[model samples]
Target: EAGVVQSPRYKIIEKKQPVAFWCNPISGHNTLYWYLQNLGQGPELLIRYENEEAVDDSQLPKDRFSAERLKGVDSTLKIQPAELGDSAVYLCASSLDAVASGYNEQFFGPGTRLTVL
Candidate 1:
């Protein structure tokens, strides 16, 4: 099975600029998720899409961040007027929700490391 894929593993942007990250989840998976990982902390969920519905996005910073899961496949996350505190790893994960309830086996991408200066 193919695993999650993300581009531009590292990124550096000036404050106020916009940045975007992409993700391609595993094949045949029905659940896609995006999480933010601050330094020295575990990944905090930003959004989760079950097929096409954003079932969970309580942790997402709505002020400047947005996401989408069109076609219920690949997804993208965008940050506009980025802030310094937004510097962190953007991780994408996919799970076969049909085969399991818990995300213990979710496959994670290498992640995109962003730095705001």
Candidate 2:
């Protein structure tokens, strides 16, 4: 009955440092998503997971970013060798189905704000 949960609501690190974010989706949700939002821009999908399989991750930066949703529940997103441009809010959302529609509402966590100096 709980909503999505994320850790370390805020994080600050220097460039080249590594940062990690965690998310726990709502119970019974079958789809999960990770999104990146830059200031004044809408959230863009970084990765999407259906159950334990990663269905989409084209927007994710493979060079320094990695994510995993294990056992179809908890998920983690990591950005290594963080860059100054990586400063933004990382949001985690979950839905009851993969095929998003007007009837399916996605619940979002407060999100993790990462600052790279």
Winning model by lDDT: 2
lDDT by residue (tens digit), candidate 1, 1-117: 668999879999999999999999999888999999999999999999988789998988899999998999999999998999999999999988743655447899999999999
In candidate 1, how many Å is residue 64 off? 0.5
Model 2 vs. true fold: TM: 0.94
Highest TM-score scorer: 2
Off by over 4 Å in 2: 100-103
TM-score of each: 0.93, 0.94
**For each candidate, what is the lDDT?**
0.92, 0.94
- Model 1's alpha-carbon lDDT is 0.92
Q: Which stretches of candidate 1 lie over 4 Å from their true place?
A: 98-104
Residue lDDT tens for model 2, 25-103:
9999999999999999999999999998889999999999999887999999999999999999999999988676655
Q: Candidate 1: which pairs clash?
A: none
